[model samples]
Structures are given as C-alpha cells and as structure tokens.
Target: MISAEPFVSGKYLIDGNWVDAKDKTTVINPANINEVVGHVALCSEQDVQNAIESSERAYHSWKRTPLEERAECMRAAAEELKKIIEENVSLYVRENGKVLVEAKKDLLRCVDIMLQGADEIFEWSKAESLQGPQKVIVRKRPRGVAAIIMPWNSPLILTFKRVVPAILTGNTVVVKPATNCPLALMAFLHVVESHFPPGVINVVTGSGAMIGDVLCTDPRVRTVAFVGSTETGKDIIRKSASTVKKIYMELGGNDPAIILDDAILDEKAITRLRMGILKAAGQVCSAIKRIYVHESRYEEVVGKLTKEFQHIYVGNGIQPDSMMGPLNNKNQFDYVTGLIQHAKDSGANVKTVGIKLDPDTWDQGYFMLPSIVTGVNQQSEIVRAEQFGPVIPILPFKTIEEVVEMANDTEYGLRASVWTENEDLAILLADQLDAGAVFHNNHTIFQDLHLDFPGAKESGLSRETRHCGMEYFSDSYGFAN
Candidate 1:
C-alpha cells in the first residue's frame, strides 16, 4: 500500500518555492527501523532568516488583502485539501507510525478545521459598533506574521489547527513541523501553499534547536503558536519574551480518568475508556495517563480493561488490522520503556496484554505491549509523571475528596474525564477536577470542535480553538470620533 510520491515536497518552502538545504537527515519508520521512510533537509540559520524575510514581505500584502478575497482563498484551499486527504492517509500512518484508523482521523480533522475556519472566520471578522459617549467602532486587525511550531504525534491536525486560524485571519505564517514526522504534513501543505500568495505560508524542516528561537525572538512575528512538552513551551515563552509577542501553547497533560462508584461498566463504556487510554498508543497529550477507580469497582474495572486490551492488535502501521503502532521515535520509545522498568523495579504489580502481530520481529521495532500497573502510591514515578505510552496506572480510592486530591496533584492540567451513570456526580466531579476540558462517558478524539480548549495551570497558557483562540491571531483596535 506504499506509494513513491506521498512524501515528496520542497526542502524549504519559502516564497512558494522549494529550496534545498545542504544538510540532509534520514527518517526511519519506528515500527521497523530498518525500513527508511525518507530523507528531509535540515535547514540552517540562513534558511530560517530567508523564510522570516519572505513571510514579513508577504504579510504587508496579505494583511491588506480584502476579507472577501481571503475567505474565498480559504474555501478553495479547503476543497483542495479534502480531495487529497484520503490519498495521503497511508503516507501519514507510515511516516507518523500511528494505526491506519488514527491516521485517517488526523487527516480528516485537518480538512474539518480548515473548512470550519473558512466559514466561521467571516462571522467574527465584522466590525462592531459601540454605543458609547464617543461612539467608538471596534475592529479586529491581523497581527502581521505568526510562527507555528508543532509536534509530531498528530502533526497534520495540530499544524492545521494553528495554520488555518493564522492564515484565514489575514496573517502570514511560518510552520516548523516536528523533526520526526514532517514529510506527510508537508505533502498536503504543498497543495494548500500553491493556492495562497508566494510567501503567505512557509515551512522549514529539520532540528528545532538550530532555528527554533529565531521565530520566537523575531520582531516581525507578532504571535507564536506551539504544541509540545512543558519544558519546550517554557523555553519558547522565555525566548518570546524578548519581543513580548503573544503566545498560544498546548503543552503536556497528565490527564486523569475518574471512575465513580456509579460508573457504567458496559461494553460501550469499557471501549470508550480503553480508547481514552490507548488512542495513538497513549501518546496523546490529553490521553488518560492515570485512572482513579472507585474502591467498590476497582477489581471489575481492572478485569474488564485487561480483557479489552488483550484483544488489541499491535503491529506495523501499514497493517490493516493494527490497532496500535510503535512509538514514533527512539527517544520516546526509550523514555516510555524506562518508566515501565522503574515501576517494575519499585515493586509495582505490572500486568501486560496485547498480541504482537510479528513476535519474531518485535525486537526490531520500538513496540511495547499495553500494560496496567497497580500497587503504586500517588508519588510513584509512573503515577506522578506523564507516561505518554501504552502503560496506565489504575489506582483505587474510597473518598471523592481523596481522589480529587490525587488527580490534581500533578503539573499537567490539560484535560480530564469522569465516567459514571449518574449525571449529577459527573458534573460535580468535573467541576472539582483540575483539568481544562472534562468529558462525560467518553474521552476519545471525537470532541465538539467548536468548544474552547483552555490549557489550565502548567498544561498550557491561554486557550485553543473556537472564538477565544481565533481572536488570538489578531488585535482589536477601537476608533473614537
């Protein structure tokens, strides 16, 4: 099912053209490291400088482009994206090392975000009339250039989330895709870039350390949008402070899934819970990292979940029946395995499930079976940290107050979920939880795209999606007569 052209794109897409860089980096499929995916050009400092210069020059004109014209461009880009998305699904799975189903969802989300932006941006673009003593009129204007620094887990969707809002609001953007899975996203970007002005959307690949800070510290870039670890986000914040630019970040999340006493353990609920834990092999920023089950139902929850996880098929991404793929890179694979080893050494009872499709070659890949760990304290390394792997710790608690305390005792407060048949209890616990978005019943990739996703506490700063985040791309100026 592999094709030759799924990952062919310009090295540095600046000024609507592909310029090759001197250094090249090879990309390997994490599922089978022996199988090389492709090679990407590692951009230098000069290449980054050229991109910012091009983006700044385009910003002056792009910001001036009429609203109707910009709207039409977005619509056209959305349509083009729709036609090519399905074709690129296979490429995404191979490049990103996620299952086929997850890869499809990632690509489709890109089209959905683009289409939604094309329509909703117009709704808020209108100037408002204020009935004040001075009769002031308020209008939101573009903030020149925006820098989009993205992560690899769901590169296309995460990149588009920032790219759509930034460009549709009349601001030019420079995108830095994660070094791990940059090619698949760039293929689609190539199509969208052809429709826009020469330098309206530029992309630079390779190491973020070499050229990441320039985008944040540059005076021309008025806003920085990023998705990654808390440590990296903090670094970006420090760099962005130099220019005092606005920043939109979605950082690390130690998401908690609380199982209330009245929690429904039907097949559907169990499936949804497993999804929350295993989606993208639990590499998602908002995945259920730690689960707190009521004491009365702890045994049943573990038993049911163990059976569910056992049936899961772990294999290469290209396999149609693969439910989960390997970790995206060696660094992550090593980090996750290390956490599991530490837990095991600390006397934690670890239960592993899932069948490797090819057991003989499993050692050659960065694959790990799904695991459930118990007998760990709240301060245990696995319990306190974000595993970002297939391993999840299931803890039992007697009191709601105690469970709430345990769940909130982490630096990450991105998202959490409450699973229960009682709606009142779910709402009450949701209010008490320290997460930004609380889900009832299900916590999958399926979410209302219109809702505002605010990053609470250490998880992130500001908000993402919906009206609040869309507004971050521009500034509102009031004119008084």
Candidate 2:
C-alpha cells in the first residue's frame, strides 16, 4: 500500500486542469474515524457553472472527432488503467471502507467497462444506412453536455458506466463525485481525463444541495445521469423540467429473495445468499433487502444462513482477513442502526452475529454486525424500507402466490431473485416478478449481466449497471463521434 502519502484530491478538474478550491471536504475512513483517508476540493456554484460551460464548448469539437479515433483513445486509456487498478484498489479500501476484494473488483470493472465499452459504443454509434419506405442514411448525434452525478458505493464503476458512454458518443460531461468517496475516482479520472481533449471531462466536488441544481437545471446539459435516492432523483426531475433534459436515473431498491420449497440450501447457496446481503456491508441499492422462505424451511434457513453470516469478519478493509468493512459513512451507519432498533421495537426478532476484529476498539469505527431479523411485519420499516445495511429480514411464506404478492408490494423494484432447483418453475415464477431483473439462481453475478432489465416502470430509467457494456441496448445507438 502507498503509506508514504495519503491520497488527496484538493482540486476540481475543470477544462482539463486541476483548479484549487477555497473550501474542502475531508474524507474519513469508515473503519477508523481517526484516519483522514483524503480530502476533496469542495467547489462552489460558480465552479459547477464553469465545468458545465467547459463541457459545452468541448462538445462542439469532440463530436466532430472520428469514431475510430475516439475509440482508439479510450482503448489506450483502458490499458493504462490496468497499471493503476491495484493502487486505486488500496486507496479505495482506505477511503471507501469496502473489503479489499470488492475494492479490487470494483476498480477492475472500470477498466473492462472502458475497453469493452469502446468497441460496443463504436459499433452502436456508427452511421447507418437503412430503408424504411425509402432509403435513409441515419447517424446518431451527440446530446451536447451530460451531467453525471455519482454515489459513494462502487464509485469508479458507477461513474464510468455513464462517463464512457457519454464521452464515446461525443457528449462532454461534468462529473460530480460522491462527497465521501471522491478520492479514488478523482485519481482514476485524473488518469483518464488526460487521455481526452481539454474540457471534454470535468469534475466538481460538493454537497448536492450546494451545486447539484446547477448541474441538473442548466440548459447547457442536455442529459442528467444520476444514481442516488428516489427522493433526490425526484428533486432532479422537478428541476430538470424547465430545461427538459433527458434524465437517466438509478435509484433505491428493496430487492426481495424468495426461497422456494425445493430451493437448494447447500453450503455454496447459503454463502452466496449471505454475500448478497452483506456485500459492501449491504450498502448496495439492489442487494437482497428481504428474504421470504417457505414456512416449513424458515427456521432451518435462518439457522444455516446466520451460521454463514456470523463467520464473516468485520473490520478495516486494509486488513488481510477482513471479509467486510464498516458502512461508508456515519449517516448510513446511524440510519441502519435506527432500522434495527425500530424492527426490535415492532417485535421483530433480530439475531446479531459476526465477531468484531477488534473488540477493544469496536466503537472507533462505523461497524455493525450482520443482523438477521425474523417475525417482522410486512409493513414494518425494516421490512418495507430499503435497509441499506448488513441487516436482512427473513419472512415465512406459505404459498408461492402469497410470496409473489408480498415481493411485488414495494415502491422500489431494482432487482429480485428466486432460489430453487426447479428450472421450469423458476422461469415461470420469474416472469411474474415486478422487479426489473429476476434471477432464477442468482443476481448481480457477472454471468447474469445479460439477464438484468434496465429498470422497472416505477423506478426511472435506471439500470443496476455493473459490468454492463455501452452496447447493452440492442436497439439503442450512440451519437457517432
């Protein structure tokens, strides 16, 4: 690890240069509050405006660049990214507080997205000749400037999914990094922005309240891409009305997992289920939020699942054996704690497990053990709300019909999963789920990338995009560079 110097992103990148800011935001290590992982420059409203203006100017020239030339530059950057992936993984662990394994995977995914995105976008965005009643020459055109607002969890991958497609299509972007996790992405972007032309890629760091409106409402930005809460997404939608921007949003999900009567509950299946809930300390938007098992197998399922989760090691991500780290921030930590408390108050049986790596200093970090709750009412906060923490509630379902209804009863529908040995039955049941992505055996696995749907009707045009290529949509093509 690079211990000699802690990562610092003290300048906002605007017009291809790192410009210093008067105010700054210090990123704290969620595993160790005393450690200042990094500091990001907090830009003002004027700074955001400058970024948008620069992106607008860049779009004019960038759109004229050859498609092959644009693809070539992005491919080279993807190669260079391989060199820094490990270093950024370490930095991500320190600043973001996810396990080292997940940190590496998240950073590595960024490189793949770029490399594959280049080819996919290249093919998709090229000019097309077609006959529809009469011969037509069709070419995709760039949408001018795009505003990409990201979240802290999976920072690099989340930001790049939008960034690569936007830039490859010749739309310049002003990126807003999450307040607590900007360090790694800023560093990653620093490497990438240099590969592109000046003003093509810009970044601004600050609270959404201070600068987000400017990014979303500005007419210069033709599209607004955001990944955050439903409430925030709605707020952006309201603001974008004046400008009528093309908005792409990936919001919250209380994804459900149904354990069929014939579902496999072997060691491997149980481990996968545990990771589904505990991964990123359950900060994932589409992670399994609630589980419904056949009433006959409810006790057995809880016994086996808790046994696996209880063995997971919770500690600082930098450690060798730390399987999972603390939640990324205090607000998230507090909100999760409140969720557990409320569930308990409502007569939910919460089984807290996991051995703290450092029991003597447990309070030093924003750590919470895996909480497996039972007896939770369908309407309780823990059951209904998206408890984005390492806490999951297991409910008993007597019939498939009843469970399907219970699973469909939610405002959030990012993704869901059904675990069963019955293949035909699984596919039939999956068709009935209201969730965008319904998996028979798994969800969020790399193999399941093609199975995911972009978004449910309730959630806006949001995709749980991990390892998704820019050519994800068969009919959709980019603006030819």
Candidate 3:
C-alpha cells in the first residue's frame, strides 16, 4: 500500500473560499483493495444554491469585462494548472486507477486544451464589416454562470474542454466533477481559484443524481455542459430545457473501425489496433468496440491482435511494469464483468488474453483479463450495444458496401475509422462511414483540441471544442471563441 499525505490541502472552492462539503464522499483507490486516498465533499442543495448565486452575482461584472482581460485570467489559471502537473498525475493514478504514463498524458493533454482555448480567442473576436457605417460587431460574450458536469472517464481534458472556454468566454462556472474522479478536476479548480477572482470558477463535488439535478435546474445557471453516458445527458437536456438554458452534451459512443482487405497486416498496424481497443481498459466511450474486417484479412488481423493482447501486463498502476490497471471503481468493474458473462452466455466466441495472473490476489481488487469476441452474427447483442470494456467484438465482411452498412447499423454515430493502405479506398470508406468524425488510417482516438468533436443520433446534441466549446457559454446563435 502507498503512503498517503494530503496531496491537496484544500477542498471545495466555493465563492473563493477553500472549504469542506456538508457531507463527504470517500474516494477509493480501486487497484489497491478499496484503499481510501482522500474524501470529496458532497455539496448539499443549499451549497448548490450558494454557488449559483455567487456565479450569478459575479457574472454581472464578469460578463462586461473585455475579451482580452478575460483571456488573461484564463491564461493565468492555465499557468497555475500547468504547475500542478506532477501532483495532479499522482492523484489521478491513485484514485482513478489509470497507469502512471496514461495519467501523465491526460494531464499534459489538459494543458494543451487550455492553451488552445486561449490561442483561439482571436479568431472568435473577428468583427465583420457591414454594407453601411452600422458595423455589426458580433461579439461572442459569456453566457452566464456555466454549470459544468464532467464525467470520470477523462476528467482533466474534460475540464479544459469546458471550463477553459467557459472562463475565457467570460462566464463564471461551477464544476461538479464525476465523484469517482474528482481529484484532478479539484486540483485544477484550486489553481483557478488561486489566480482568478472568487466565483469565477467554483467546484462542488458530489453525487450526480442529487447535486447534479440542483445545478441543472437552477435558474442562475445560463448554460450547462456535460460529458457522460447518453441516458444522463438526455436527463440533463430535459431538465435544462425547462429553464430555457443552453445545454452542451458529449455523451456515449459505440465507435467502429472498418479494416479493408487492402490494409496491410504489418506489425505496426496490428500493434496500433490492439492499443486502440485496450487503452484505459477500454472504458472510454470512443474506444473501438466493433471492428468490421474484410473476410480475407479477418483471420490474420485476429491472430495478430490475440497475440498482442496476450502480452498485456495487468497490475497496480504504481508498478512500472503494469501496463493495464483495474477499472476505475467497483461499479465499472461489475458492469464490465457482467457484460462479458452476458456475451459468453449468448454464444459469442470470448477469448481471454494474457495469463490469469493470480485469481487469489484478484479477489481483493477488481481485475479482469482483457477480452476479445469473434464469430458473433450481425444481430448479436454484443454488436448492437455498447460494452464499454476492453473487449473487441469483430465481424467479417465481404464487401466495402456491406461493411459500411454494418458500421452504420447501430443507433449511435459517434466515431468510425477505416484502415487501408490505398488512399482512394480509405477516403471513399471514410466518407461513407456514418460517424461524427472519421479516421482514414487510424482508430477513432485522433482528437485534437481544434476539431469540432461531438456525436450524432442518440450520442450527443451539441459539439464541444474551439468555437463549439466557446458556444457552450453563449446562446446557440452567438459565436464565441
């Protein structure tokens, strides 16, 4: 067990004060036998009311501040955020069960998104010349008190994606990070509160069902930003609509990757595909859950992937050799395990990769071997639903048209990637793929801060990034960078 010193001295930055929650929720290190790393304060309804009122009071003057001044505040906060890089990664790995290297990557990615928001402000401020002297200065101003409800999957990046733009756009915010992964976002808000004024960025961590409802329905919040599953996003949309508030959502994704026969089954391509499906234990919404491979190369690709999966080193994240760690929490672990069992019982070909390690040691923690499923028919449950685990369910297709149709058959259209060495074939397949973002030669992890990332159908409503993120703080028509 790792020794615990107070990593973050303060908690709950409410109206600029480092206080505690009325009730606290204990955060466990899942990889370490439910060890208590720290406690997150669960805000009461009264706490939510206070935060909203504080943001509302500050918005009066904050919204009037010049865009340059707002950008300066965001930059200062970003600098503070950068300072906590090492400390934040430590907390993330301990509490969230991600490998140390992956946690560091997340922290760095968060910084990039923050800087991107600052750099893109100039483009958002461009004024257009009208036909007459009545120059239409289409200024993109802050929406108001933005209530940001971020999920546990990617807390740091999600913070920068929403909080940075909301702050740069001149909107005061109250962040309610997913209780399971509040540590990193809490550290981030601490940096903001240190440099920015009170109420500019307040964080209240708590239960989503209880505290989230208060934040979403409160009249003081002009806009609500969320990143989570589809069911919860839909609920927030319904609640926010009653208040006539702007709702920005980034929900679930059942992404697919189509491998054409022209694709080379080289060592590099096979290794990349394995990493894409298994990263973060495949807990990500954009993780490649389905793969439609051309019939000719189907066996060859599966052979390569199975061999790669067999080599994964699963253990505690603190161990340097441990490439894969336990799932973030027990709920997620149980969910993934249940899904695997369901697939097995439903007659899908399930294969467990890597040695079983020690089942005796595994009983104390939530650990499962990375899974792969093949030979499942198109109408199987595994193909239709989002497993959200480190299991890739692959199907063989004879033609490009049939494969594209198979990829688009799902209720989701979040992301899809087509792998091929032939440029023309790759482009043709990418264009026909029905996803918000399509990759020609790689998996769906090809996300940059500048890209407009969102989902389609039951996935998500509005986009998030660059102007899309800035627009989260404004009316749908008002453009903001």
lDDT winner among the candidates?
1
Clashing pairs in 1: none
Error of 1 at 48 (Å): 0.4
C-alpha lDDT of residue 243 in model 2: 88
Determine the backbone clash count of candidate 2: 0
Task: Name the runs in model 2 displaced over 4 angstroms.
Answer: 1-8, 127-132, 445-452, 462-481
lDDT of each: 0.86, 0.83, 0.78
Clashes of 3: 0
Q: Mind giving the per-residue lDDT tens digits that candidate 3 earns over 57-113?
A: 878888777877777776777777777788667778887778889989988887777
| Model 3, residue 186: C-alpha shift (Å) | 0.4
Best by TM-score: 1
Q: What is the lDDT of residue 149 in candidate 1?
A: 94
Clashes of each: 0, 0, 0
Of 1 and 2, which scores higher on lDDT?
1
Rate residue 143 of model 1 by lDDT. Answer: 93
Better of 1 and 3 by lDDT: 1
Quote each prediction's TM-score: 0.97, 0.94, 0.94
